[model samples]
Target: MSDNQQPAKNHVTLLLLSVMLLGAALVFAVAADAPHTLVLTAAGLGLSFSRRTPLSRTTRSYVYAGVSVLAATVLQDQIFPVDTQRFYLIDGRYYAPAVIFLGIAITFFEQRDTTLTSVISLALIGTMIAGNSGATIVTNPRFPMTNGLLDYFHFFYGCVVAVQMLAMLAVLPHVDRRVRLPAPGRAWRWHRATVFWVSVFGVAGTVVGLRVAAIHYERLADRTFRDLFRVYMRRQSERMIFGYEVDLWRTVPPRTRADKTPVVRALAAQAPGYLRGRAFVRYGRGTWSSSDTGEHLPPTRPGGRYAYSVFRRALAGRTPSATPPPAPRPATIDLLPATAYPLGGLLAPGNAVEFELIADGLNNSNEGALVPREWDVAGGYSLALDDSIRDTAYQGPAEPPTEAERYLDIPGHIKEDVARVANTVFGATPPRPGTQGRLAQLSRFFEAGFTYELGVKFDPAGKDPILQFVEQRRGHCELFAATTVLLLRAQGIPARYVTGFVCGERPPSGTYWVARLEDAHAWTEAYVAEENRWVLVENTPASGFPTTDSASGVVSRAFDRLLVAWQNLLAQVKRGYVAEVIVALFLGLCRGLGRLLTHPLWGPVAVLSLGSAVWWLWQRRRRRRLAAADRLLVPTRTELQKTLGVLEKQARRFGVERQPCNTIRELARRLESAAQGPLRDALLELLREYETLRYQGTPPAVEAVAEFKAKVRRRLAAPG
Candidate 1:
């Protein structure tokens, strides 16, 4: 390998290979109906990693996976429709997101921008997007159009993955060479090992890493995620908020993100007050969890506006009193929930028993919390209640007085911050009387200095998100609610965490109030012994609530309604195969096997046939291995030409297709991807020699050519 012995092909060929792989992947993703999210994930990660930050292929792959999940999964509302409006912002100016997105992608398409870092960013990021997006487009309600379509889809995805792996493998060596000096001085054995290991895990790792990447792309490309980059402006106003659950503690690799997909619709003339969802009795660390000790009411269809079920006084923790009847307004709306089980239940501004409520089924906790049964929770449900009031008490189980202590308890680690905030807000004032007075007192915390913001991230560098939020005086509803709960608990007011939607908007044509994911919120519910029941307390600043313009845009609302309608259509189309043909075939095969075994007459023949098939496979594999070994030992007619053919066949077998335009150098690189160890390095050296001689316009002497071919044969025969 002389310095002047240049390879015939250049980076252009590699560029074409990389682009082909990317295009193939995107084609499959888009055809699978997952292009929007997959493209967003790739563009977002690629744009970020393409900046001058130094990172490795392996490191980039892992980072892409982790950050994509965090940004796209836990906070889907904030991340999706990355561009909702016709225009997106750039340096405070508006531009079409599609133009900007496509522009950048094309810029990187050419290998002119290719570097060790940039190329890996493209390859690895593309892979994560393709695998994750494709996974989402083909699951659950997405039954195959015909029998075995899912299996065929999976096979297609596998082929696309194979293409990506082959391209990356081919480009990896050049990427390695561009970043390192050819020779290194021999040092201590340990030091040599360090250098060897530090060559970015050397060539062998590409194979291992190829399999390791795309491990969790499915999460980022969540089925519910909407990459509304086209809706950039609409996306701009969308913010991350709490989902259906009352989750307090921060999560790691969250189980799910906030979904904007329409889950349920409440059709009513007026909006439901705080559609009370989940109520948590216990709080620890930074999380809130539920202790659901209640009863499951079977589906009840009572006569004359039949109430689906009733919330007994025992569950409300209320002694019989002059509880006002729910305002008579029965409305119907089908729920299109996000999960298998809709976590939170509706509160239609009615007394515990006033409004009739039932899904396919309902679960009532002793504390008045409700959830739909495991699966059948969609379609229409009926409820009657007044929509005038926004403030409502969330109740819990009635039991031993000691049980109330749990609400007053605060995580010991944050007791200091809690005390500080309580003092700042309450300021030694005498405890307020009744639930209203307590709520008035709690509202002071929001007034004191805090500000409501949606684009907030947890700050782990200083104190926990609790104190940091107080010190900084800025965050979303979750922060406002969590801090308010902590403030009240510090003063001995029994408070529990609550989460649900604040429904307000009605669709253009429909009477029902539509509660989009952005409206998801958190508020504190405190128990006042004097009131004999829990009462709602909204401590979030007024700014936290959606504005008329923000929440009730006619176009945005229309688009949302249409999107929901479309989603509902897809979910209910149900035109695919009614039964799993694969399962039926399996069962039939099982029955045949059983009959054959039981008959005893045919059992021996079956076993013999199985044995013969296995033996045939083994023999075929052995023969291939033997033929491979023999070829490596003997050189064919032409010097170097025979070796190239063998290498080409090996490369093709590994899914590395060669173009007719490929030069010998391009062929060698592709072959190197399928070959490894001494065989790979030997190919590189032999190619260099042939190029050097060809450049000089002189053929190598017969003896030298013979010796060169023999040397290559020896290297091929050598074990890795």
Candidate 2:
């Protein structure tokens, strides 16, 4: 080689060495947590090419880089099967090297810059950004997404990736740099042809390897996961944390952010009857969230219980003869909550209810496993599930579905400053003997510094919004919920972000109420038991809502009365159905027995029967008269006045009751003589509204009436 060419060759050699070193670093970092075989192969391939000669310096560098990437990918596939984990770049050994080498090849070898190149580069960058974005920070323990290390890393990595791509473009020649070959004699050309064919074969092999990878991913992605089903005997549930290491599954495209894509809509459709996975009472938004630990047993019997059966809301409506065979009786199903919701998808085991799915019974519907029954399990259940359904399918298998690990991915471009905050919050050590104490510490840390604020515009200006929120502590529930999942996951909890109404209502008239957009809430759920069951904990402050008083302000507290009514009604309804069946059977039996008794062989029985019928009619008429009188009886105005007088007389005994037309302030003043401070204040506001509606001018708003009903329901339902 010419001396001038030697310089270029040396430069390429140095570049190849840099690739090998970087690959080794990533392998070392990732292998400690999740080891991959690809690192060894990548190292060997790069070393092999270090001493080999190619037709030209340019060809040598490009081929060596390509081979290194291909080798690394093969190694990754061998060790970290898609079955075990999702496609996370840093978590898996091969992805980083593959991406890095590809970047190096595009940057160093190809010196041509065209519109196509720019377009391709932009496409890759966009995917990286999309993949790495949507992090949360939880200084306040209110949101872990903001506080977690991985999310910060994701944003940081994404930015790094973008910068690398841009830097590559800047370094590559803006104009075509393709080299031309001089014509040779026929005899010499034959030797050149043989070399060219060998090169082609190598390229073909590389392409085939990539094709095989694509096929493998396709199959893995299509496999259906198992749905967890069982009833827990206690609070502790056992489960395998499937997506703990990867964040890829949490990837939500910008286009799908607004509407209920298959996932969101699936959860929304089951809203009212859906048994919530956990309840976090602390967040500002009014709802139940799954972000912390709860007592294994219901402190009291779980209230607000609703029976859910997935009924097809808008089916294809096949005619009777053509309808599919009753959906195979929901034998085993995987249930997953929408990614948009705050609580992680809940998996239940034991006493599992028989399910009636809303869509075609397929796991791909993203409606996770529907666990039947009302009992709480201490640990998770063990069951085998068929892995044939895609996330799009809504049916088959009662096994805990494998969560996509991509959801845990941290992009390569997040700003460094955000990570600084994570280090401070999460600290160097993993928190605790358990998940709850760590979360409590995190919540307290955030509450001390951050103020919950909504409707603020985020400035992405190369800095991650999560990082900014950590520093500023002002954003909507989306930020809070995301942060909860991120931080908890960082603490080694299998957490998922969720967005949904915290709590809502059905009026006395049984109409479903639409929570205002302001009612949107976010939270997190962590996998606790083997059945993949989850519990909810809250870290929100008291003043997150708009009631006259903070204690009296919660929508759930306001509707506690109605919730009781609903539960009681449900239990009663179940009994009523049994009663109806019993009565029908009893009447049928009586008629049959009477017929047998009056047969021709026993004609005398006819006379007895006629007498019995006469007596029965007489008794029925007498009972009707008594019931008629009872129905017609009504309280007179005097009686109502007497009732009011009695109420006034016994107000103290029945508990505190404010007078009609009394303002909360007035009630407080009157109670000053006998009232305690905070509790008195809360009751004053609650009763103030009640007094006004019962005795003042216009009736309360439907909202107030509903609120009143809920309170009454709770009180009546409370155990003495």
Candidate 3:
């Protein structure tokens, strides 16, 4: 390759590497939600290669800038379709393309003059901020300051600034060095001015265009763009389905084909049967809604007497005299990693008397939901619960109160159909006139008649879902539970729909149960007025419950165990418990060593040994130093004499041999006169330094003596 072409090639290579690194970082960071990051990265590489084409520098900069803006505009329309009402600017998928294309554009212009590049960079930053704002406002009704806008701004700007700075640092050093020439005429200056203004205007136009496109796409560029940007927001309750919509009216469950997706990794001394989650008391057209609006109970302080009293009262029930009921039994529940939402799940059946431990921000409780004030938390807590109460009929008043009215809510349309089914199954005259008998009969009826199947599809425009499930005799756990709840409510037995995970395989460790996504289930919780507490009634057939039998191979089980270990590690990190343990162990070891060393006999022996070792080390280091100094001092004498002899022989060829009676400095002057040039100067300096070091008590520095010797050797070796 030619000399000129090599550096240019290197510059392009470096630029490409930087761009790729930046692109890869972005892709991996957000690719799970936004795959288009890869496409933009590839396009950026293509633009970088085109820099080799025969085009003016100015023209190339403009071309790249224009292409970048066009790419951003196109991507905005493609990723954010007009039909979607909600736009999550925080979603990397929405803003990745714009950032990638603009970054590439900034890199291209970075090789140009400072003023133009700076302007382009500023324009890019402004464009990004404006586009983000426009997209945020269009998709969300809230003002700019709310919902993590400040954090988003800091993050977005930080990324843009970092990428731009990296690109500039990579390319600026390789900019072509222009030869000094006469100043250009006024017309040339004017042409330059015009190009600058044009670039400015072009960037402004692109920014405006991007904002417009993001706010509302006039026409989608292609079907891929349309499909790629299509927004499908899943409700928070559908997390078990892994972001897929779970239409209540649909026959098939949303997430039926199961792989091993862990729902909870728990370790306890005993198996906690089920971890219950959100419950809905109202049912309408196959949908379940919770409308209890229960008062939020403040979390009791951990160790206070008031806290203990509250827990004691809740667990013991209203004691006639407050003679202090016996302490409740405590069970340790460890929530491993992989569990989502630290609070919303039933720890144990009875009232939680006291929490052994809890993660920060998890201090709120509702009727059946225990959640943190904030959404982000990872560890779990052990609690003391009164597990003595069995799931029996309530002995309280049979009359329903205003609070119980919500559980009896069934849609008017399905009321008659559900009541007819209930009467047919349990008999119209109440064989046993209590809630427990009716619940048991209903459960038995559904388990006998309905077949538990994961894959069942119903027509969108068909009969009521409950009616269809009853007639078809086939559905998943959701359908069975929904039907059971509706039937119970229709028969005036207050019931609610409950969602949670059933216990899965017991690991060989035999400590805790592992609950996977497939274990997620829905069941009916009938309110037993007699007991003043809800009782779980399993209406779903046995076939639907998850089992750890040989169907799941060794690999799946191993993966689950690995997940549990990983979660434990994360919990330790968050609580700093691992660090504390390490520190404690280190201190303990130090204390033990100190105690051992303080013994009179061992202490004297140790001191003597340590002193002997220190003395030996000092002697050894002193010997090495003396040896090094001797080598430095002795080598100079022999090497200098040999070098002078070589120089004398070379001088003899010029008939200027040194005399033994003459001083070295005097001899050097004679040699210089014979061979007058750089060779003469080197010989003089070398001889003068040699005389000073040989005679004077003060020896020259090791480096100076070595340098003088090298000069003498070079002069001698030259062609005479």
For candidate 2, the per-residue lDDT at 348 reads 27
Cα RMSD of predicted structure 2: 40.4
**The best candidate in terms of lDDT:** 3
TM-score of every model versus the real structure: 0.40, 0.29, 0.49
Model 3: runs farther than 4 Å from truth?
Answer: 1-247, 253-259, 297-330, 337-367, 380-384, 391-403, 430-433, 457-463, 508-512, 530-532, 548-551, 579-720
**Tens digits of per-residue lDDT for model 3, 181-268:** 3577998778767765665566556655665775575455555555654532222344433211124685554564464556666676
Model 2, 1-720: lDDT tens digits are: 311122122334334333433433332233222233334434443553453332233667667767756654543433332221223232323344355445433433322344225424533533342232222321313223324444454434434343434334333323344574555789767977776556555555655666577567865644431111123212113222111121211322222233212121111211121222322222212222323321121111111221122322111111222223322222343333322222222332212223332121212112232322331121111122222211111221123423534233333444244345555666766544455566677677667866666445555353455555665676555566656655655554555543333323332333222232233344555544332334343444434421121122356444644543454333333223333444568789999777877678665776777789999999999767545444543333222223333334433543546554544466446665663644444444545545555554543455655566566445434423
Number of the candidate with higher lDDT, 2 or 3 = 3
Give RMSD (Å) of candidate 3 vs. truth: 15.7
Clash totals, every prediction? 16, 115, 6
Please provide, for model 1 over 449-537, each residue's C-alpha lDDT reduced to its tens digit, 9 standing for 90 to 100.
77876556665555667777778787777777777777878877777777777776666666446665656667777766765666677
Instruction: Give lDDT for model 3.
Output: 0.54
Q: Which candidate, 1 or 2, has the higher lDDT?
A: 1
lDDT of every predicted structure (CA atoms): 0.52, 0.39, 0.54
Ranking by TM-score: 3, 1, 2
- Candidate 1: deviation at residue 74, Å? 38
